[model samples]
Target: MQLFIHQMNEEASNDILTWQYDRPYDFYNNERTDEALQEILDGSYYRMNDENNVLIGFFCIGANAKVPAGNEFGVYNEDLVDMGVGMNPTYVGKGNGFEFCMHVIRFIQEHYPNKAIRLTVATFNERAIHLYEKLGFVSEDKFQTLFAQFQTMIRREHQ
Candidate 1:
């Protein structure tokens, strides 16, 4: 499958909705509500897809995001663009994740020299941890959630 970057127009809203419904934990929570998505797309975040019109994921270059304990503003400071991606749940476990992300990361890194990409996976998500590490991210530090559960997680950073 091939990938294309599209803006969130009238046509791609459905795919965004599909992603929201599929990954509630990461994409449909309070932080990623309908309005949040609207903002993301409205901000011209790059949406990913293949030749079949399948929505792979999306990422925003130079996205200034708040990373709980980590402030990612000007962190990469050069060509680094902060990116995030999600694949439709139905298409998961089909071995497309690694290839998909690898392509996205390489593309962005080449275009944005010295652009460091970063993502946050839950402490319990080993598959994602391995994928990020395999893609070259390093474990920076362990951070504790300030919420009532007081759970902790290791923050991975890559450049």
Candidate 2:
């Protein structure tokens, strides 16, 4: 599970656009466009790769993404770093989620050690919620947005 995390470059972003996932998961897919590359270059996204240098996935940290009911769900807080992640569709549902998340966690720790982490997920994303719990995140609140219900989870220092 050797992994590396780096700021996404144009080449990496272009490659990522080719990755796909199943229904629902695919809804969060990246786009193949210049705007996508610009977003990556802006530093809101990261490119992840394995020891062999194969692109594995990508994750977002401290992006301040505005989810539905962020305030109501208590998912957004100044004290905690917000994280969002996705694995290459080719690598998902094959028992690699935990490892992928661990890499993202380690990357975050390297840059923001001691900072608590928070994430918001669709209520229907049971798989992601399970993995987050496995990684020491606990749901703190839940709320409904205009489009869907969301749950806010947090991984505090004590955890």
Candidate 3:
């Protein structure tokens, strides 16, 4: 699937806020609130669409992608390009993760060349963790928040 990343917009952001995932994955769900919409439009977030123009997911970089608690743990010490991603619930478990992630990685590389990429994920989400690992993201650090434990993974830029 071809992915096109664009500046976050209200319609796509609203649609993303309505996506519902099952059980544990529901932790990533967002409410259609003013604050939520504001967050997505905060400049750091980008909307991802497929070749067919369907919203496939979204990506957020920089400080917005880092869990606040990670600061206390010193997990964000490195100046890596941090990223947070969310796939549309409908596409979740459809074996599209690898391709989707590669597209995101390439996007980041183009925009931020020579920087290592970092991602923090809930430890419970083994599937995503596995996909990241397969993409050359190695386990870097682990930190716990009041609600969940997260593992930070990193993929160094190619020389």
Per-model tally of clashing residue pairs: 2, 0, 0
- TM agreement with the true structure for every prediction: 0.68, 0.87, 0.96
What residue runs in model 1 are displaced by over 4 Å at the alpha carbon?
18-34, 64-69, 72-80, 146-159
Question: Deviation in angstroms for 35 in model 2?
Answer: 3.3
Model 1 TM-score (2 dp): 0.68
**lDDT against true structure, model 1:** 0.56
- TM for candidate 3 is 0.96
Candidate 2 stretches greater than 4 Å from native = 64-74
The residue-by-residue lDDT of candidate 3 on 43-108, one tens digit each, is 999988999999999999899999999999999999999999999988999998888888889989
Ranking by TM-score: 3, 2, 1
Deviation in Å, model 2, residue 148 alpha carbon: 2.7
Please give, for residues 1-159, the per-residue lDDT of candidate 2 as tens digits. Answer: 788888888787788777777888776676777776676677888888999998888888775444645875455656788888878888888999998898888878888889888888888889899999999999977888776788878888777
Q: Which has the greatest TM-score? A: 3
Per-candidate local distance difference test: 0.56, 0.80, 0.92
Error at 19, model 1, angstroms = 3.2
Worst 10-residue lDDT window for candidate 1 reads 147-156
RMSD of 3: 1.1
